[model samples]
Target chain A: MPIVDLANPSRFLALTARLMPWLIGATVLAFAVGLVMVKGAPDDYQQGATVKIMFIHVPSAWLAMGIWALMAIATFGTLVWRHPLADVAAKAAAPIGAAFTALCLITGMLWGRPMWGTYWVWDARLTSVLVLFLMYLGVIALWRTVEDPSRAARAAAILTLVGALNLPIIKWSVDWWNTLHQPASVVRLAGPAIHPTILMPLLAMAVAFLLLMVTLHLAAMRNEILRRRVRTLMLMQAQAAPGSAS
Target chain B: MSALAALFVREVRLAVRVGGGGGIGALFFLIVVVLTPFAIGPDLALLARIGPAILWLGALLASLLTLDRLLTADLEDGSLDLILMSDTPLELAVAAKAFAHWITTGLPLVVITPLLGLLLNLDAGASAAVALTLFAGTPALTFIGAIGAALSVTLRRGGLLLAVLVLPLTVPVLIFGVAASNAAIVGPVPFGTPFTILCALTLASLVVGTFAAAAALRQGME
Candidate 1:
């Protein structure tokens, strides 16, 4: 009965404590191989070494979109199941998503300036990405600015879902508008255009980025749980000082 | 309908006595339009080219400045509870309030646009186009911005959050609004497509965000 009752935090924490080292080990292994592949990939026939930015840019862009989707699902989960952790999951995700979004933007600029001869362009894809970056920062800033944690979570969740609705619009806006940004090359109808030589490392980096995101998400969740615990303890102490502990 | 009309009147009266939200929003739009030419360089041809877009964007930003007030005042003073309990569907009340908000903030921008258009050197045709687009576009902003307002009603600092959350969703409107005005000048395409899309965006916002916001408000009041 005691073992099955692991829904309690103390039990959950004990289990997680035992599990952390393994997750950390796996993350390190994935990143190490991923970094080597990224560094060693042949220069692009067209873009030259600047194409290496693709290794980071593609994954970060993917994660930037993926995290928002995850946050929306977490939000809908909280609204439906009233899951205690779902709110925390969303609140913790804002910064990580913002970080990936920032990485995507920075790497995108590095690639863009060299190829397009400008740091910024009003192309549909770039414009959509810029909006995504702004949305992420807004989510992060909103979560931090609010005094009430639960109110912040709900607000952030609404923002997340709203931003998620635009991801499809942004991705397709280029195709729909036929602007400067190219349509999907790697994920196209005839499959990836790049030779397997480059494709293998790109896939590896993507897997590594996902693994790293999971690690950060777990750590962020732990930090949130700790913050909540301290807040509860502070409230209890505030009440207890005027009355008996019982 | 009368019940919602009553709420709309009450909201507008409250807005007016609270220092006039829409007028201030229009003032912001005028200031942005006036200041942009010096910075972008004072070429009337260039100004004429971009005037519609600048006016539409200015309206979007200015309307954003007022969106936070939509629910914050009600939430703060406890009127939100009464609104929640009314037998009228909260969605209808949202529409009515949003309609009033548009009248206050958006109408002023539409009225004052030609005045600002002179500063930007926009011709009469483009000015008319700007007014028409702003008139169409700003309602959609209110409708969409209301959802963010409703979501962030309980927060102390929802103003910036509302802008960040709402602006991207607003791109479709801004695009078509300006495009319609541009079409008026260029004659490459008719204004029908952009104008129809703007109407569609407004309707979608009303149907979706309205109900979503009302549902959330109901939850909070409970």
Candidate 2:
């Protein structure tokens, strides 16, 4: 089928319905394998048992940024091409993205208390991530405030694009201002600083988190399409009723 | 050209006259600055240490307070629709309004910062630095804020929502603004670096915010 067919709500719904179970199953399997790998990994020489938290924290942070990047791409779709399903994808991803960002912050704090000797610090990484979380909330609030779906989508799209442009600047300014959080260890040009014992679990958990995010996004988009359908049906019925003006 | 100039002048005049604009922002800046010394107690050193931050924050919040009125007034009075239908491009029109906003709201806050700096126990040089940064920096706030203003123009009681949407995006401006001031006051690092970055931020926001805000305004119109 042509990719354009996927823009049709019914076609998209049918696709998601068929894909949902497999996605859910894969997500569960990934999580189970990831957790087992995390458990089997030896404690860090420095961080000890608390290093285990890295499995969840790192993946959540990755997903937090990943989801926004996805939304940013969807934003271009909404604004440039006027893709019908693009806004649905963007809106569906927001709350889930916010949740992951919150999780990243909370778990970072939990990790910090034991490792950094404080519940929180105004470290560059921490501060930028907090800003990201706030940005997510703002996007969600913008989504809710606009009653018209198409208008809201375009408005939110513009905001998201502006935000995407700002994200690097935010990260750069924070990095320039101070340094408390350790610099990137994984995903560096020099290669992974972590041992394979730990790296395996982190990779597994990252995959698991990605799967979970995709599953939730698909479900949310399905619901949004259905909600639009219900609204259209209701409007049609109201217009058909006696004495009701179109 | 005359149309754009007229719109800019009209926006500035309305901002000064309207309850949501100039006077309130300056007053709120004063209150925030004045209340800080009492809240932190009379430790002169401490006050001086954080003074630049307090002033930058005051300027930030004050600019935010006046931002909701930027486009909403035009929107409510039906001027926005007329502006949309006009021959001039929407981007230039949005930029004009934001420039006018900086003039009426942001510039006053910059003017008052030196006086507020005295309340924070900052030295003359420190106060001068804060004022200079605010002068260079607050336009970024107003211009960037115009996007939020445009986004929230259709909503009732959108002032708070405007803040939420705009504040995080202003972090770079706030960071470099305060950093530039701090460098001037008490830094081993040279002041020129952050000051230059702050200018770049202002210029970048001028272009980015204008285009984004115009797009949002167009979307909202539909």
lDDT, candidate 1, B178-205, per-residue tens: 7788888785778887677667767776
lDDT of 2 by residue, B7-48 (tens): 998887787774645788899999998898788898988999
Give the Cα error of residue B162 in candidate 1, in Å.
3.1
Go through the candidates in order and give each one's DockQ: 0.48, 0.94
Provide the DockQ value for model 1: 0.48
Please list the residue runs of candidate 1 whose C-alpha ends up more than 4 Å from where it truly belongs after superposition. Answer: A1-12, A170-178, A243-246, B13-22, B187-189, B219-222
Among all candidates shown, the one with the greatest lDDT = 2
lDDT for position A230 in model 2: 87
Model 1 C-alpha lDDT versus the unseen true structure: 0.79
- DockQ, computed on Cα atoms, for candidate 2: 0.94
Scored against the true structure, residue A204 in model 2 reaches a CA lDDT of 95
lDDT of 1 by residue, A12-106 (tens): 56666777888888889988998898888899888999988899999998998888888999988567666557788898888899899888988
RMSD in angstroms, all models?
Answer: 2.9, 1.4
Q: Write the per-residue lDDT of candidate 2 for residues A1-246, one digit (tens) a residue.
A: 998888888899999999999999999999999999998999999999999999999999999999999999999889998887999999999999999999999999999999999989888988899999999999999999888788889988988999999999999999998898888999898889999999999999999999999999999999988887888898899999999775
In terms of docking quality, how is candidate 2 classified? high
